[model samples]
Target: MSERSFRQTPHTSHDGSNSSRLSILLFIFIFIVLCLLARLVYLQVIKGPEFSQAAADSRTLSVNISPHRGTIYDRNGNVLATSVDAMTIYANPKEIEDVSSAAEAVASALGGDADEYAELLKQDTTFVYLKRKADMDAAEALKSEGIVGIYYIEDTKRVYPYGKVAGQVLGFVNVDDEGVSGLELYYDDILKGTPGKLVVQQGGGGIPIPGGTEVDEPAVDGQDIVVSIDIDMQSYLEKRLAEGVSTIEGEDGRAVLMDASTGELLAIASTPYFDPSNPSDSEVGSDSLKTVTQAYEPGSTFKTASMMAMLEAGVVTPDTTIFAPAELSADEYVITDAHERGDMTMTARYVIQDSSNIGTSLLVENYLGFRPLYDKIVSYGLNGQTGIDYPGEAAGYLSPDVDTWPLITKYNVTFGQGISTTPLQMARFYGALVNNGVACTPHFLISKPQIGETLQYDTEQIVENTAAIDPMISMLETVVEEGTGTGAAIDGYRVAGKTGTAEYVDEDTGVYAKSSYNLSFVGVLPDASTPLVCFVGVNEVPYERNTTEVFKDIMTEAISRYRVVQSD
Candidate 1:
C-alpha cells in the first residue's frame, strides 16, 4: 500500500472512533441532566406543597413554655407557692388588617376600652403582649370574640394560694414570670422550669395550622422544693404578729421561729408583708424579708453572749456574786442598769433576770476583759453573716477593729450597744446555748432534692463549747421565770428569753436617740428541752417600755401554735 493512503486511512478510522466516544459521553450527560430536571419538577409541582409546607414549618414561631416553676411547700407539704397553666394574650399587629375593628372586638371581649386596644394593634411591631397570665375565663372570652390579630400563648403563672401568709418568705414573680424578689429571686434557677420551643406552619393569614405541624420539644418542669417552714405555724405567727403590730401601733416588726436542734427555720414573717397574688397592690416598703436581712442592736438580749463569755473564761458562775448597782464604769463610759439597784450584790442569774447593764459590764470586765470578750462574740458567730439560704443577708456592722473602738465601745458592747446583729444570727447564738453550746449555721431551705424526693442538708456546727451552754441555759430560764421576759411565760411550756430596748443612734449627732428604740425579745421555748429559738424585733417603737409586750405576744402565739409542752 502507498504511504499516503495508509496515513489517510488511519486518520479516517481515528475520526470515526472519536465521534462515537463523544456521542456516548453526550448521551450519559443528557441522561443525568434529564434526571435532575425530573427531580426538580417532582419537588416543585407534584410534591411541592408538602415539601414547601415542611420548609415553612421549619421556620417556626415559638411560644416559650416557661417550665412550671417548682412548687414551694412547707415541711408538711403545704403549698406555699406553685405554678399553674394560664393563657397569655398577645397580638400579631401584622395580622390585624382592620385595626379599629379588631381592637374594638378584643376590647369588648377582654374588658378593656377599644381605643387602647386599637392603638396596641396599630403598632408596627410583629408581636405585642396584651396581658400575661390571663385566667382561663378571660382567655376563652377573647377567643370567642374571634378577633383577627389576637392570639393566646400558654404560660405558667405563679400562684401563691395562701396569699400574704408567707408573702415575704415566698416572694412573687414579675410580669414575665421571672422571680424578682425573696425566695423567688434567690432560687430562680432551681425554681424556674426550663423553657421549650414549638414549631408549626403559619397559614396565609399568619394563623398556626394545627394538623399541619412539625416537631415539638416538650418543656421540662422544675423540681419541687420542700422548705423547712411549717405552714400552719407560719400562718398563725403571721396573723398574731400582724395583730400585735397593729395593736401596739408599732412601726414594723419581724419574727422568726427556728428548730434549735436542726437550725430548720420553722416560720419567718415580717409585718406589712405583700400578697404574692396581687403584687401590684403591694407596697414596696413592706416587701423586705427583714428577719434575715435587717440588723439592729440586740440590746440586753446580747447579755447572753456576755454571760457565756464570762462563764467560759471562768470569770463568773451562776451563783457568783457581783455588785450590780445602778452603774458601772467600763473604759471612759459609765453603763447603768435599766432600774437603779442601790448597792445590791446579786448572782449572775439575778443579773440576767434583772437585765442589768451594770452587772453584765462588771462581769464581762472582771473575767473576759476586752480581748477575750470580743473574741468570744466573734466565736459565737455574731460578727459575721450566718450564711443562710435566703438572699440580702447582712453580715451586720462589727467595728472591724477593736483598736478603732470608741471610748464608750466596751460599755456599749457590754449591753448590746455599739453592735448590730440580724434576728437569725441572734437565734443561732441562742440555739448554741440550748444545743450544748454547739452553734450551728442557720438555714432556710431544709433540702434540695431531685424530682419526687426531698434532700436534707446536714447542719454545720460551727462552734462546740459545752462549758458555757449549761450555765447560760440556767440563766435564760431564770429570766423567763423571774426576769424581764416573764410575760413570755407559757402555761404549758417553760420559756427562757430576754427583752431588749435598743436606742437608735441619731444619724447626725452619732448619739443614742431618746425617742426611738428597737424593741426585741429573744427566747427559747420548752425551756426544759429547749427545742425552739425565736426572736421578734419591732423597729422604731414609740416607747421602749412596750418591748416586753412584743415578746409576750410572739411567745404566747408560738407556744400555743406549736403545742410545745412546758416539761418536755
Candidate 2:
C-alpha cells in the first residue's frame, strides 16, 4: 500500500544527490579557472620585463659607419691617392621573402652568379654583404631597381687617380678600406680614421622600418699625407726606366731622384713595377718594393764613398798622385781595375774618373788603415738602415768586424767587393759630399704644415767635415766630365757622378759569378748649389749590354724632365 504513494513521489532524495554532485563539479571547474588566471597574472607581472627586453633586442639594429681614408698628396699638394664616399650593397637574408627573385636581380646588376647569390640569401643570417665599396653610380643604379631586401651602406674606397703613375710608392688598400701595401700599409693607422656606429629599430625579418630614426655616431676622416714625390718627375723617370730596361735586352733598371741639399727623395722608379690599384696583376718577383729594400755590392759606386773617406782622412788630396795598373796584390788577393792600365801615375780626379780599383784599394791599404776606412764607411751611412718611411727596409751588409776580415777582405771592401749597400744609402752618402759635407737623411714625405704657408722640413747633417769637401766635389765632377761614368754626362749640367759594375754572387754555390752582373750609377747635378742627387741600379745585365749606357739614358731623361741646369 505504501509502494503506490512512493512511486508517485518519484525519488526526491536521489534527485537531491544528483544536484549535489553537479555543484561539486562546478566548484572544481571554478577552482581550475582561478589557478590558470593566477598563472597568467604571474607571467605578465614577474617575467614581463625579460621577455620585452628580449623582443627589443631582436628588433634593434646596428650599422657600421666607415671613416674616410686619408688623401695622399705630392710635395706640391697635388692629389696622388685619395678616398671617396662610396655606396655598398648588403642584404638581410632572413628578410628575403622571394630569395630567387632578389638574388637574380642582384646577380644581374653585379655580374655574379644568380644561384650563388640565391644560396647566400637563403641563409638564416642577419646580414649578408652583397657588394662592398661600389662606386656611387653603380649603387644608385641598383637602388633604382628597388629590389626587396637590398640595402645600402656608405663606405670609403681608396682611389689612385693617376692610375699606376706612382702606384708602387703610393700603395693600395683592401676592400674594407684598410691599407694593404706601400705607403698605405706603412701609415695605416694615420690614414684610417675612426669608425662610427648607428643604432636603429628593425622589424621581424630584420629589415629596418621606414621613419625609424637612427642614433648615429659620426665618423672621423683621416688626415692628408703629403709626399716628396714630384708627379712630373716620377712620370719622366718611369718612362725613361721602362725604355732603358726594354732597350738593354738583358736587365731590369731602376732610378732614384733626390734633393742633394735636403736629401728629400723626389722620385724613385723601378721597372716591372706593380700598379697600386691592381697589385695582384703584377708579377710576383718583380721589383715591387726593391728600391729601398734591396741591397747589392755596389761595385764602383762604392768608390765614391772610398774617395770621400780618403779625402776626409787626408790620405790623398785631389792632386795627390797614385800609381794604377791592371792588377795589384794585397795580402793574398790581387785587386784589378775594370780595364787594364799601364804603369800610370794619376791625380785624385783621374783615380775616380777611371774607376781605378787598384788606385782605390791602394789608398785603403797603404794610406787609410782598416779602422779608419771602416770608420769612414760607417760614418757615410753604410752600415745602418736608412730611416725612410717604408716597410721591409734592410740594413745593408758590411764586414762584421776587422778581425773577421779575410785576406782579400781589405782589397775586396775597397772596390765594393766584400761589402754591400742599398741605393738609398749611396744616394744620401753622395748627396752629403755634394751638399757641402752635410749628409741629410733621405725621406719621402715633405712636411708642409699649413696650406699656402712656407713648406719647411728639417735636415740632419750626418757628417761635418769642412777641410776635404771641395776636393770631393772636384772628383765627382771629373767623373761625369771624363770618368768611367762619362755616359751620365749631360751638357751644361756639370754632372757629378760615379759608375759601378758588380758581379752577383751565385745563391746556390755561394761564390761570385761573372755571368750575372749588377750595373749601377749615382750622380749629382748643378755641382755648385747641389739641388738634386740621383742614383740608379740595374740588375742582371747580360754580356752584350753596357751598364754605363743605361745610366746615360735614365739620367738624361730625368734631368730633362726636371728642367735642371748647372749653375753659371
Candidate 3:
C-alpha cells in the first residue's frame, strides 16, 4: 500500500530481494544432493563387502568332526584297545515344538531319565549336546522314533574287548576318548587323531540349510599301536595272580613274567587290578601298574645283585665260606636270619639260598664295604628306574651318601632290608643275570610309527663280570631245589629262584612292622642259559606263605605257550 506512491521503486527492491533468496535456496539444494551422492558412493564401494560378510556370518555355523582314533593290538593281532563307531546326540531346542514329548522320546531310546532330558531340551540355546559319544545302536534307536529337533553326529567310543585282562596296562579313556593312564596315557598323542570341521549355512529358524552352502573338511585318522603283550598270556596271568592273592587273603600281590633273553614283558599282573571298562569304580591309586609303579624293600631278592658284586670284586668265591651267626649287631640295628638258628658256617651260596640276613651283612660289612656295595646297587638298577616303557616307574630308593651310611644301614642294604626295588627291576635283573650279563629293555611296545625317538632298549652289561653269572645262578637253583624257596620247585624242571621275606616298613613309624611281611619269590625256569624270569610277590600275609604256587602255575602255562624245552 505504501508502495502506491513509489510503485516503480518498491517493485525493484522486492524483485532484487526475492532474486537473492532464490539463489541461496538453489545453492543449499545442490549441496544436499552432492552430499547424498557422496554417501552412496562411500557405502556401495567402501563398506559393501563388510556388510555382506556380516549378513553371511549371521547365517553360518561351524562344528568340529572327530577323527577315528587308532586301534591298539596285541602281539598276536588281538584287539586290546580300540575305538568303535558311535554317535553324539545333539538337539535344536529352539526348533522343538513339544519339548516334553521330544525329551521323553530321546530318553526312551537312550535309556536315561526323561526329566534330565527335559531339562536339556528346555534350554534357550540353539544347539545342545544331549549325549556325547552315545552308543551307535542307541542313537539309531532314537533316530527311528523321529523325534523333532533331535539329531546325531558321528563319534567314537574307546572299548576294551577283554574286560579286565591287561586293564591296568591298557588304561582307560575319558568320554572324549582321551587316555588317562597306563599305556593309553603314554601314547595319547599318537592315538588321538587330528580333528576336522563341518561348516554349514544356517537357514530359517536357525536350522541347517538343506542343499545350501556347506563345506566339509575330512579328518586324518590316528596311527595304530602294536604292543608286545600276548593277550592270551596276559589273560591267564591275570586270572592266576588274582586267584593266588585271594586264596591266602593277602593284602595284595604283583607278578611279572619276562623273557630271559629278550627282556620282553610277556605278562604283568597284580591283585585288585583296575578294570578299564569301569574306571570310575577303580581305587584312587589302583590305576597304577604295580609291577613297575610300586617299590618296596626286596629282602633276599636283592641279595643276588650284591652277592654277584662280591664275586666279581674278588671279595668272595662260590666256594668261599663265612661264619653266619644266629644274630649280629650293626650299630643300633640287630641282624639275623629269617628263621631262628644256631651259628653256622656257610658258603656264599647259602647266604642267598637260605635268605640269611646275618650272613649277607657279614659279607658287605667285612669285605665288600659300603661304597662298593652302593655302587653295585646302582649298577643293578635297584636304586633307580629301569627306564621301562611304562609310565610312573618308581626309581628304587638308595641313599646317595654312602660315605656317611651307618654300619647297620650298610649291612641291611646287602640283604635288601634298607634298599628297595620294584618287581620289574628284579625281573630285569634276573633276565640280565641269565642272559650272559646283557639286559634287554623291559618293554611292551613291539612296533609303532616313529613319532619321536625310536624306542631303544639298554643292552649294556649290568653284570660287568660275566663269569660271575654262572656261579650266582647255581646258587639260585639250589634255592628252589632245597632252600627257603623249595615251595617254588616244579616237577621235571630244574628251576632257579630266590625267596624274599622282608618285613614291611610301617608307613607311619618308618620302622619294620612286627607282624607284616612282604613275601616274594623271583625265579627263572628251564636252566640258567635259557630261562624265563618270573617274579611273584605278596604283601601283608599273616605268616610266611609261599608265592611259588602262583609262579608255578604261571610258568607252567608259559612253558606250554612258549614251547620252552624241558630241562633234563
Candidate 4:
C-alpha cells in the first residue's frame, strides 16, 4: 500500500461498515422478538376466552324440539282434537346439490308446486322449511327419494277425531300446528306448549360428530282442556240441522243447545260444515261458526223482547186484547203479518202465539214505547255481545239514536226485523226466560278434566225480574200447546218456544225478498231443574218445511235423555 493511503484504508472503512451492519441486524432481531412476545400475550391473555367460545359455538348445533299441543275433549271425555306424532319436512339449502331436482321430488311426494319448493331450496341460509307438520306417509316417501339436503323433523299434527262433527266450534290448526279459529283459536296460548332445545357437536358437513356430547332441554306439554260440549248432543244437533237445511233446500242453518241453569253449552252446530282435518276444502261461507258469527234480523222471534218489556211495565196482561190486522201502516211504512188475517182481535198472549207483526208493533208503540223497549233489549244483552266464550261474536245492531228513532225502526225492531241477533245470543236470552229470569253467560270450557277438576264460570243474572219472565214463560208454554210452535212439542213433555219467519232484503233489489225467509224455533223444557234450551234457525228456507221439525227432533231426544216428565 502507498504511505498516503495508509491513513484512510478501504479495508478499515469496510470493517467499520460491517460492524455497524451487524449491530443494526441484532437490534432488528431483538425488536422482532419483542413484537412476537407482545402478540402472544394479547392472544393468550386478552381475547383467549372470546375466541374459544366462538370456536365452540361454530362446532355446536342447536335444534328446537316442538312440544305436544294440548288435547281438547268434549264434556263427555271424548277427544275433539288432539296432537299426534308427525314429520316436518325441511331442507338444508347449502347442502343441496341440485335445487330444481330436489324441489321436483319434494313437491311430487308432498303434493305442492315444484316452483314453490325450488324457491325455498334456493335460499342462502343453511336451513329452510318445505312443509311443517307433514303426514308420515308423504314425508317418508320424500325421504326415500335419497335427496341429501331434504330432512325430516319429528313434530306434532293436530287431528280432529270426528272430522266435520264439531269442526266450526273446535276449529282447525294451520300447517304450523297453530289454531286459527273457534275454541282452538280462543285458547291458543293455553293449547300451545313451551318448545325445548337440543345442542350437539356438529362436523364440517353439518352432521353430528361421532361421540359428541349432547345437551337437551325438555319441552313442557300443553294442558288438556275439557270443553262443555257433549259430543253426542253435538252430533245430534249437526245431523238435524244438516237434514233440515237439506229438506228445505235452505242456504244453511245453525243451532245451539245449552244448559239453561248453568249457562254451559251442550252443543253448537252449523250446516254446510267443513272438515277440520282438511280445512282447505271448506267452501267460502261455510268456514265460520255461524251460531256465533252470523247475525241476522230475528224476524218475529224478537217479539219476545217486546212482550217482556210490556209485561215489566205492567201495561199488558196475558188476557189484555189487541186488534191486529193483516197489514198496518206505521211511520208511513206498511207492515204485514205472515198470514192474511184482515182486522182480527186477539189477546196479548195470542199475539205472540200467532207471531203477529202488527200486534207486536202496536205493543211497542203503545205501552213499552221506544226508549223503554230499547232499554229492555239492552238489559237482555240484545244490543250487546252475550259474553259467550267464543271468538268473532257479533254485537247485534240496535238503533244508535233511540230517542228520535224513526217509526219504521220502532215497528220493525218490535218484530225483530230492524235489529239483528245470533243464535247463541238468542239462546242465552231465552235461557233467562226458563231459568227463573237469570241469563247466565254461555260458555264451552267446563274444566281441565284431565286434572280431575271443573273450571268455575261466572253465572250472571242478566234478567233478574221474574214478574215478567214467569208470565212470559206461561205465554210461551201456551204457544207450544195451542199455537204456531205445535210442531216443536215433544210427546210427553210440555215445550215452550216461539217460531219466526224472518225476511231479508234482496241483494239484487235492496228490498225485502218476498220468497226468502229465515225460519227459526227456540224451545226449553220448563220443568227440568237444569233446563236444556235449544235453538234452530234455517236461513233462506220456506216457512212450511224448515227448522220446526228439527227443533222437535232435538228436544224429543233431550227429553228422553234428561228424563223430563209431564206433571199434567
Which candidate's TM-score is highest?
A: 3
Q: What is the lDDT of every predicted structure here? A: 0.77, 0.76, 0.82, 0.83
Candidate 2: lDDT over CA atoms?
0.76
lDDT of 2 at 176: 69
Q: Could you give me the TM-score of model 2 versus the true structure?
A: 0.85
lDDT per residue for candidate 1 within 123-205, as digits (tens), equals: 87656877778777778888887777677767778888888887888887886667888888888888887777756456654
Model 3 TM-score (2 dp): 0.88
Each candidate structure's TM-score, on Cα atoms with residue i matched to residue i, is: 0.84, 0.85, 0.88, 0.85
Off by over 4 Å in 2: 1-57, 213-215, 285-288, 329-334, 341-347, 448-458, 526-530, 544-565
> Which scores higher on TM-score, 2 or 3?
3
Tell how far residue 80 is off in model 1, in angstroms.
1.4
- Cα lDDT of model 2 by residue, 75-103, tens digit: 87889988887887888887778988887
RMSD of each: 6.2, 9.1, 5.8, 6.5
Error of 3 at 92 (Å): 1.1
Where's the lowest-lDDT run of ten residues in candidate 4? 4-13
lDDT, model 2, position 14: 79
Error of 1 at 482 (Å): 2.2
Summarize candidate 3's per-residue lDDT along 58-81 as a digit string, tens digits. Answer: 787666777788888898889998
Clashing pairs in 4: none
